[model samples]
Target: MQIISALSEVSDRYPALFVDLWGCVHDGLKPLPGAVEALQAYRAGGGVVILVTNSPRPRAGVAAQIEDIGVPDDAYDNIATSGDSARVAMFDGAVGNKVWHLGPDHDAGFFDPPAILSNPTPIERVPLDQAEGIVCTGPFDPLADPSDLRPQFLAAKTRGLKLLCANPDIVVDRGERREWCAGALAKLYTEMGGESLYFGKPHPPIYDLARRRLAAIKEVSDAGILAIGDGPVTDASGAMGENLDLLFISGGLGAVETGTAPGGDPDPTKLNAYLAQTGVSPTYVIGTLR
Candidate 1:
């Protein structure tokens, strides 16, 4: 399962791909070099590629932000975000009452909350305890990210409220720096006896919806589709649960924890260790799309 091929060779085999946007395609600040070119070539080869991200923003909102960051819309055939799935339940008022905001404004807008916490940082103390549940988008700052709020989340748990993790990625690249994500906070909250609901991949509904969106393509099914991402749990594990082929990158989340140098791809040993833990080894190992 751990094979190395030039990026182009991998593209040749799989005509359709479900690519993770943030870490795999861009770093939330700019597109990775040759990522655009790789996708362009993939498309040029008569392939279809869709970007599937766990960003809590709506697909349109996410796509816009990526475009602003210089990732062309042509990079993928279509896009899906966790917000796209969670909104169905949100609109139905599943959680019913208003949610206390904890992340970014775009994330809050996913619920299209009539009212939002205008203040982004300082992780409001009083009103946060007042809301029905907490929906975490990300840590405002990594140094003081929500990971530092393990105790605070426990206090919220005492009040008997749910925690909805909009973006389930544990970490993401903010340009050259890797920061904590909502899922990492959610995991801590779970360990602290707080309840949570996640609507992102490595989870079933998200992948189901993504595949259904690709039904128009006659030949894309079963072994033909590939899911590419950086994380073991979200990207690799989720794809594993779905019985889909995957491409794992050492350049993204695994870059440092596995002892790889900055801007360099990960080695196969650490990657194998990651897969061994996740129980999902990918078909390909790409340092980057380039």
Candidate 2:
């Protein structure tokens, strides 16, 4: 992978960018330094920016959250979230009518019907034992270990209920604190023999939704699009699967492994080792979005 100092060095090559949010643009609690400016600058040059995120929130919810986190509206053109993709699948009966919601109250918005579906299946969130399927936005507690859900997952597995994972992220750094995501729960469920359906990064459904969102604003092909993100498993894998160029931000989740300091470049040797270990070959690597 080529280690670049800034996004401007390669921004002109793509007509559109599919950018990840949590690590590339923000640190969960606030916008990352230089990220907003870079995106805004790219847009000023007539490039389309689509915030393709694995967030469990819908597009509007993500927009509002980012706005509150200080990422302005002008930074990007549009957004496509995993929650929306999974919600569509949920309402289409990917999960049965009655589902047990396994997440915090803030993620209750996952039940909100998408406007695009004219006649969606009526869904009801019932108790775990009474439900036909499970909709996991995340753990009820982000800081708790995923193994704690084994008992519940075993019950679901015995019942043969499919799990619809809203966000396929294993974890995210909220400032300096790391927390588990829905993917971790889904992963555990699958390990215990329960089927888990993912609709986020490294999966096809969210990418399909992102393309549709991009198509509404611009008609750029996969070759004309660049994917920027920090998660090797999620972002890098997703970009590679979709045959898009990826700009991997090493300083976010892999900073320790890459020996990247804040606002500094990653050590080439360490970065290479990390990439090799993860088995992800990104087109470009940056310490941060800038």
Candidate 3:
């Protein structure tokens, strides 16, 4: 874990970056002090930066929300979210022709403007037997355990459904609540003989697409890309999953034991352990974006 306080250190090592939102850049509503400035500086130095996030909403919607929260649009080259990837899989014919919805009701609006499913949501499996596939947005019960959705998952599998997980996160922190996400359902379904294709971080397809997006705006390559994120699981895993150099921010996901430091506390030892366990190690580990 390399402790860096200056943006120059980051730019010298990696010219193109994939930065995570939420825990790494801002909370839901506010941007951190140096985060935006660091990003601004990174861009000024001939580097291309992309805000790659696990946001449940589509890429455009998530970008709008970030702009609303004050992360200057000029700070990065592009934005990609899990929801955006989900849109691709939802519409991609290879995935399936008909679909079944297994997520929150708020997500209904995403299906419009581009007809994802011919039938209105809460689409029955019986009708979907010959349809495209399954679209999982969230857990049937966010409050229930990860195993709670086992029954429906089995039914979906029995129907020979191809699963598309909109949110690759099994659990996410919404302020203080640890809510189960579509990833949990996907994992369970996979265990019960259902194959789940995830659309967010740690998945190579999305990573490659994000890189191409950056390339479109600026000259970029894999070696020059550095992924900075707050969580060892989603953000870190996403970067590592794609075999990119990574910087793990300690304060984002949970107050994981950061070595006792003022303004920030990140336990480098814990990070090492997580990296070893996941078979993915970050190139750098910092307490915060600063």
Please, what is the TM-score per model?
A: 0.86, 0.99, 0.84
Tens digits of per-residue lDDT for model 3 on 1-290? Answer: 57565556767778788988877777666786678888888888778888887666777777778899888898888887777767765665535656777777777754543343464333323244455588788866788887776666677788778888887776766555677778878888898998888878777767876877887887767788888887666787777677788887766654555552434646667756655765546677666686
lDDT of all predictions: 0.74, 0.95, 0.72
lDDT of 2 by residue, 28-89 (tens): 89999999999999999999999999999999999999999999999999999999999999
Q: After aligning candidate 3 to the native by TM-score, how far in Å is the CA of 275 from where it should be?
A: 3.8
Q: How well does model 3 score by local distance difference test?
A: 0.72
| After superposition, candidate 1 runs with Cα above 4 Å error | 113-126, 145-147, 150-152, 216-219, 257-266
Whose TM-score is higher: candidate 2's or candidate 3's?
A: 2
| Model 1 worst lDDT window (10 residues) | 116-125
| lDDT for 56 (candidate 1) | 82
Clashing pairs in 2: none
Q: What's the CA error at residue 72 for candidate 2, in Å?
A: 0.3
Model 3: residues with Cα > 4 Å off, grouped in runs = 113-132, 259-262
Q: What is the lDDT of residue 24 in candidate 1?
A: 78
The TM-score ranking, best first, is 2, 1, 3
